[model samples]
Target: MKACLNRTIAAAGLAALLVSGTLPPASAADPGWHTSSSLIGTSKYGDDFKRYDYVNPNAPKGGTLNTTTAGTFDSFNPYIVQGNPAAGFAGFGGGLLYDTLMEQSVDEGSVSHPLVAEAYKYPDDFSSATYRLDPRAKWHDGKPITVEDVIWSFTVLKANSPLYNKYYANVTEAVATGEREVTFRFDQKGNRELPKIMGDLVVLPKHWWEGTDANGKKRDIGRPTQEPPLGSAAYKISSFKAGTEIVWERVPDYWGAQLPVKIGRENFDKRRFTYFLDDNAAWQAFGKGGFQDFRAESSAKRWATEYNFPAIQAGDVTKSEYPTTSGQPMQAYVMNTRRPLFADPRVRKAITMAFDFETMNRTLFYGSYTRTDSYFEGGELASSGIPQGKELEILEPFRDKLPPELFTQEFKLPVYDTPQAGRENLRAAVQMFKEAGWVNRGGRLANEKTGEQFRIEFLGSDPTDERVATPYIDSLRRLGIDATLRIIDESQYINRTRSFDFDMLALSSFAQSQSPGNEQRDFFSSKAADTPGSRNLAGINNPVVDALVDRVIFATDRDDLIAATHALDRVLLWNYYMVPQWHLGKVRAAYWNKFGIPEKQPGYIGVDIDSWWIDKDKEAALAAKYKGVN
Candidate 1:
């Protein structure tokens, strides 16, 4: 089936998008609607006008850009660390020193041209793949990028980084074929997912990193530095002032400076990232002009009201309008299928049917979100319009495994928003309880045998979560079910979810990679359920889902692969593994207006870093306009 999907896409018109420098013809617009150009050696993004080399001949570069995420960074080693602001910064910061062979476009709609490699070739069967590197690819220190570097990366990542284990577990062997070539062979056949996986794997250098192991064996190259390390990229870490600041200077002789993938993206020669433990302090810095620009999360009220502050009203600040679908990553209440209460598919379905997403959106999110019905949303991959005849055939055996009402529009679960839908869903909840042997006595549901009341705790973080969750708690109480909301700090929240120690909790799965592989197993396979910090929020372990995940990873072509993924999604939906939640219609973002962003808009599907560029003219104009300003 994946072959068909791939064939259809290949036949549709993406060939033009893949080719560099050819103006996208008007006749080629339909089927490649979601496809973006992947122009080689430059940032033009194929020949699409939307992203044609948008160079401002007069635009000067040199300014500071400030952004904020959820937390502070005490650790400087983002490569080996799992979760933290430093890791987030490492994604775009000075860490690109060990430049990767390739990178995904900011939006992830298209692939970036090779940075270190000239091209990568995959076997038609996908069991083996090879990379031909650009001999010119060199580290900042003038050492050439070679096959040994790629192998060194594999050895170090597999040995030390817990996060690296997620992407590297499938590899059976990685071998250096030549000075600038490397090949990887997988343990399993029919798995064409390695190429996509390699796109996200950051490479390390062999000359600097290949060292003796703890046991002193020459082949035992240890894990790469948990702190700042080196290789070749646009920026190199200069110094990190303990708890306050991290500074990186541009590599004046960056080997890939002219590489298409690095061209417009890393224009800034130097980047300085500051840290503030408190969000309010960060906001104050932006207002006081301590930073070049601000990229931080904000409340809608603050977005609409606070921007009118004197600093903003005077045009010292500006906001960019960026929108993304809600649950762009699916985060909501998930039931652990490995646990007995939810092991029964009927119970999972019942829980989903009882969720009121519309109310949650309206009340908690200020109607700024959309409910998600599938793991894939707003794309052809979503099952919303797929021909379900075949899927229904696959679902036949599990017919009795799920309740009858699930196939209908009435019982379809939506993303939570408000309290009304919660109340409305209680009727279905009561029915599910009765069927599950939870007999209601005088309006209180009690276990059929033990007479103990059915009570469960909803574990999560965020103080505002209670605004929407409290209403659901009320509804559960009304149905003779005891539900309570427990809010904790972020660390505790992470520990709880990582240990599989909670009854119910909220989580969102965000895949920067559109080509799904490891993430599928990470989320649904029994193997990953107990793996600390993996994303299997529901802790699901059905053989059917496991089979579907394997099929997806194995399929070489497009249609069969998508069919497998769709099948897996359908099964998960049928089982009600997650009470899917809202998706942001757009990326709700806040940024400072003083900086001049470049004209090369990432072809409409923009990413945070793609749209940023220093505007010297804007800064000059602002300086002329607000001389002696705060």
Candidate 2:
């Protein structure tokens, strides 16, 4: 719910429904209904608009899109927190198996178009919202998508997933209002985002979930399963090899294929995801012409030095950077405050100060990355130059509870131009730890009162993370802190992070959006800190942060929202919950030169793979060039 528009793929689902007699016309007493909604401003497209400008409406859809995910998957279900779900099942964006009530537009910020529901209406106060489902919307099994399915999905998702529970916490109830209409009533009014977020509801097939499986076992929605759940989306699981691979076959007769919103999207006839143990294995597979056809390279080191393979030299592959207008993701070394070792802000700040990002950028990243200073990095919402006016007014009341420097000083990470300066920063960090009841005893930093050694274990799932973690761990060792890096498998990593068992995460990313709303609660609220599997990985529980989160969520206008966000960013930074990392403003991707990209790339989403199609001519040329090579 962190602005559904931030999702990489809008779960494409909807059926060709009858145009006439779906529901009764809106009453004169009712507010004007809309086929689309926007959080920041008026929607870019009207009701009669065709496909998105970023997609090729005439794109031919009959090629396999092979991708890779670094990790094994135990369950096909992504809704539950109990297991590692296969990639593409579900994510920030809608999943390949399920479709949301509304599909987000990649080209726009916080704008959503109708999918399952044709139109939605809400009063001026926005206490509640009513959605009119498309009459022709049908499940893959040919059953009509009903109000029952909608209501059941909302109830079950909230009950099973902590993420969904926190996301829809304000929505009190979902009840059927008509044959194909369901209304979601909120606990309070004036939350304009509630109605819009309700559009993100991913409707499940109630009958399929409730029915017994082939083994005649009662299906449990709360449990993990590998049975490949029923789906209404454009693709379905065609085959899967336990933890190694999964393939989704495009539905030749997908009901929504002709829908305006989906006309040129989901172009691939087959989508296959092959799993690898680590980044090296995945990269090797790509070099060997394995299942991977495209990759969005995340490691700057690799992008700078590893793209000189024979394929690149032969012009069989292309690497490019796409500019994005989306809010930059705050990737950081997250310290779990639940642990006694990081309980003190001074201690956390001390730990953060050890991360020499300036040196890392130059040595490891090849100067390809920019240091991230703000939680809302690369965006207008980032607080800067000492808050004043509206932002200052929002933070003034909480001055007594916040760090005094927050109001006086412009918050920034210490920059070091020389090795001596970096060493001085480390000395200062040690002093901070000393002030927080830690003392150096025989070269080991220990708690003064308890005589406990400060031992920090940085948990990571990817082996590639060691390139960054190794130096930071060495830095901590120089300070006489017993720090180590634990690189575990993906499964163990997921399980450990869920229970807040890690001392600090080597790397964790929080994706932000232009409009920060209800999702902020799940990310920074005290309640979320206590909720296992919540996005509040740092265990942020400050009342000032809680209050600021609410202010951002309830801001009535765009200007007010930005001001509130600036205040929130300021407070979170001053708290030193995590070590700010770096980000690339543009997306760096390398792929075989067999796909045709759109003429106009969306500014907000940058590269939408769903809009790209296999160019038959290019693919044939590549096949001829690599004939017998593999």
* TM match of model 2 to true structure: 0.94
Across 286-315, the per-residue lDDT of candidate 1 in tens digits comes to 666645355534344345455665667766
Each prediction's Cα RMSD?
A: 7.7, 5.0
Tell me the lDDT of model 2 at 315. Answer: 81
TM-score, one value per model: 0.79, 0.94
Which ranges in model 2 have alpha carbons more than 4 Å from their true place? 1-30, 91-93, 627-630
Residues 285-305 of candidate 2 have per-residue lDDT tens digits of: 787674688877777878888
